[model samples]
Target: MRRILALLLLAALGALAVWLYPLARPLARYGALPKGLDRPLNLLVLGVSPEYSGYHKRAPERFRGLTDTLLLVRLDPGANRVVVVSIPRDVWVNLPGHGWHKINAANPLGGPELSVRAVEALTGVRVDGYVMVSLEALRRAVDALGGVRLCVERPMHYTDRAAGLRIDLEPGCQRLDGAQAEAYLRFRKDALGDIGRIQRQQAFFQALKEQILSPWGLLRLPQAVAQAEPYVRTDLDRETIGRVLGFALKRPALVSLLLPGRFGNGWAVDQALWEEARRVYFEGQEVAPASSLGRVVAVVYGPGEEERAQEAARRLRAMGFRVLFRPVDQTPGRTEVLENGPGLLARDLAEALGVPYRVSGEAVLGADLTLRLGGDGRGL
Candidate 1:
């Protein structure tokens, strides 16, 4: 009887291995970074809305509307860095087979393919793949992750009864639910208009990244992906997606930048800075030290931080930068460096000052870089 039982147990184990082989085969095949991703990979990501008529009614076919948010994300496995550049929707670009129009019109004109072409033409960056996600996907993903926490810079109040959109958020840091997150991302009624919306989007993404890197977020990631998958459209295969997610789990460096441009009739692209951005960001070229030496640096201080700001200005001046002082009414919680141009000088300055930096158009007017002294500046 003992001999018979031993044989039966061995048979059962063999059968289980056979059953699991198919499931585990792919994992073994993609155990390392895929060949396609050995070098830098660029992906065009679009947040698409559906066409809507009055009374918040969607068209029967659910035609793709304007791309509200456009991002060119580069994943560099060699450097272990993810660079995200946000392109303003209102930026003028010439669409293939169509005349000059806002960049957002590409999606509605054709689809992700045309949008990809438009972006490639504008930035001269080859897109390896495209990910088009609907607003519903964003809501579901955020809800699955138990919402994301973000700091609201100011009170936001807006309502569009026709589109069934309403935003009423007070100034504070708080966790936002699915509906609230959508509202926060879509609100553009502030003085900065689309530019302010872009800034808020960047902030939202930073918050989302933080949430995803947390232990709790990891635990819920599979569920979030499953819930949002149906609403997302991507050209990437499952194997590639798996590899990308695995890479993200390693916690690579994240850098965010806005497309270098100035706002006028439409966002006018600064050709020279744009080229510099392409080289430095997409091509992985280093910024020449001489190129950054002539930049005008503005040291903006909050209440009671004048001395620290002056000291910072002096340090910058010593480093061959032209420095100026500016004061603001708002008190920031932490030090922040903002770059008005396309270069990485803000990042270099942030590293030198041991603070954080962001590429923003909201920097002090006529200044190439602005360093805002916050409560944390007291230590300087």
Candidate 2:
């Protein structure tokens, strides 16, 4: 009896295959997806903000449920890895019948069923199931866990008199429970912007995953999981849960991909950015990397500055720009855009991957990085 109790405890914490191992067994089987089982299972997790209803229920003036928070969680039983990719709800995607629309709009038009269908239709990868959550539901769950610890690299703030949400904070670590976390998750107005918001969500999720794996976090598992269910709805079954648990324990390789490249500045909003976003979070996995013709640029920045460069590169690449360059330190001397490499290292690439031209420029931190296109440059 003592051993059994100990095992249960272990399983709860998401620790090694101790007491908690069997908890997911039943659900794992129920969840084993039928169609998209060839590749690892993909589960779509959508978060709908507070809903508004009226006479326009059927043909909603807006969406039934606005799925602003999007997460694509990939579970590989064979490889023992779990990967969750996040997508901005504002991202633009081409709707089958509606021309072009925001990715989150697919939810209200179809509900879980249509949302799943549209996501699968858009991304190419089969969506085994989906989990939907409402605003209050997630807020309660985060509160139940007594909030979570999150580290802020920089200060962030948002003001919504209508929604009655206001956010202001300085850099460093902080713990946000239900109300605070909910506010942070919903607000998108900040210097960092939506991309930065997604990054915060990702970091929060990653940290939560780490904490849950520990015995301490697992001790609160049942309560947390239970609190989540009311706010969360999913098509996943019993067996699927087990598979994920088992795989999560065995495969640390499970990665979280924001996407191939970036689309726009956090503050700059546009449909093209959304269009590229849809291509990445949804359609990217379905298409082969080779067949998906696009470019990847590496924008390198120094300490305290890499984030911008990294994001710029991601956006440019996602936009199908083949102009992938590394972010390097400014060369000592006059600054100018040249078909030159990092302190002359680019000379080899300039010769090898000959392009029409190369350009370079400079910018202050927290601003934009300068660029220069070459008239006739070569490099690999």
Candidate 3:
């Protein structure tokens, strides 16, 4: 509901090509960002599923559904990049009053506040702001936007009567209604499970971006905003919305990442992987000191550079830095150092490899840096 309102209002404002700060003043007051805040901001966005009016009632034990979607969106005006990190619902973490449990429990335990705290504890990142949208709000928001087009990768068939979720989708490119979209995002019955679902959500986001920014979407903004106003909830005001929307509309560089982790006994993130994830996606700096050569976790080379990667890894190990050799999806034109966090280590390694260094969107999880051995590395 709140998201629907925010989207509609922001779209309307964007289309008008004018700032009605006075009119939006009231709405902005509710959840407005503090004035003159200019820095990288982290927003903990929770797609909540609280039981709302007109929604199907559930059993007492299952009445309060956990947060359906957990996303940390990092908006860096300086770099002009939007880094979106998805946290799987099942990732176990410590709860405030309760013992360690699945991270999603934070929402139902104490709403968004506790959820925010839990995330802060998990990621060691300060959340500047947050937005909680109910499932109903998300559904209506999608409908208000006239549905989003997506390419369903494979046939999806799932039914959970207890949860009142029924997903039956075919493989193809098509537009999805509000209900279908919700089901598509909620389905996690495949082999990859939640990880695969996260991938689909990322894809859905791309499609949603296209739909909301389209000309027709702009035209319908006023009506959508008007209809969604009552259901929306946020601490961000109109001015902040405008600013973020402006940057978002520019289609800045995007880094889509999942909190690096794996599930065995249960979903858990390795300490090293979490640290690297924070360094690259949140703090944007190295947590360990520069002299800690063991801090350098790296992937070695692209395709056809196996021998080079092996050789480089051998050298890096001798330098006391930990290195992981792996193949990349594509080969690079030249040798380059892909920095996941601060470029200090990457630059040093690049100097060693005699190649230039650059920030990378495709950062390897648990890696502090990636050495892409290109044709230039043939000499090394």
* Index of the highest-TM-score prediction: 1
Rank by lDDT (best first): 1, 3, 2
Tens-place lDDT digits, model 2, residues 1-380: 99999989977686644433443543343444333233467888887766534332222222257787777776665545555656666666666666667777887666777667766665556888887877666666666566677655455676665556677765555777777777666555754456656756765665566666666666665456556655566666656655555555553543454533345532223335335434533343332223213422334333344454455455445645444444333311221223111112223223333422222111111212223221122111
- Please estimate how well model 3 matches the true structure, expressed as its whole-model Cα lDDT: 0.69
lDDT of 3 at 16: 68
Q: Which residue runs does candidate 2 get wrong by more than 4 Å?
A: 1-39, 52-63, 245-254, 264-380
Report, for every candidate in turn, its global Cα lDDT versus the true structure. Answer: 0.78, 0.52, 0.69
Kindly provide the TM-score of model 2 when superposed on the true structure, using C-alpha atoms.
0.58
Candidate 1 runs further than 4 Å off: 1-36, 58-63, 291-294, 298-330, 340-344, 358-366, 375-378
TM-score of 1: 0.81
lDDT of 1 by residue, 1-380 (tens): 99999999999999766644443533443334433345677999999876676587755434378997999999988778888888999998888799899999999898889999999998889999998888888898899899998866677899987778889988666899888999999999966788778878877887898898798886676567666766777787766776686667668887777777777978787779878877877887876754558779888766667778888888888777998888755455467888755546887888887888876544665578888776653454
**Error of model 3, residue 68, in angstroms:** 2.5
Residue range 1-380, candidate 3, lDDT tens digits: 99999999999888565533323633444433434336777899887665534344543323245886889889987777778878888888878788888888887787778888998998888887787766665577678778888767677899876567789998666789888998888888987787778867876775776777798776555455544555545666566775675666556666666676667755676668568767765665645537736766565455566777777877878878888776644454456677544456777777876777765433454567776666543455
Each candidate's TM vs. the true structure? 0.81, 0.58, 0.64
lDDT of 3 at 148: 82
lDDT of 1 at 166: 83
Q: Which model scores highest in lDDT?
A: 1
lDDT of 1 at 239: 65
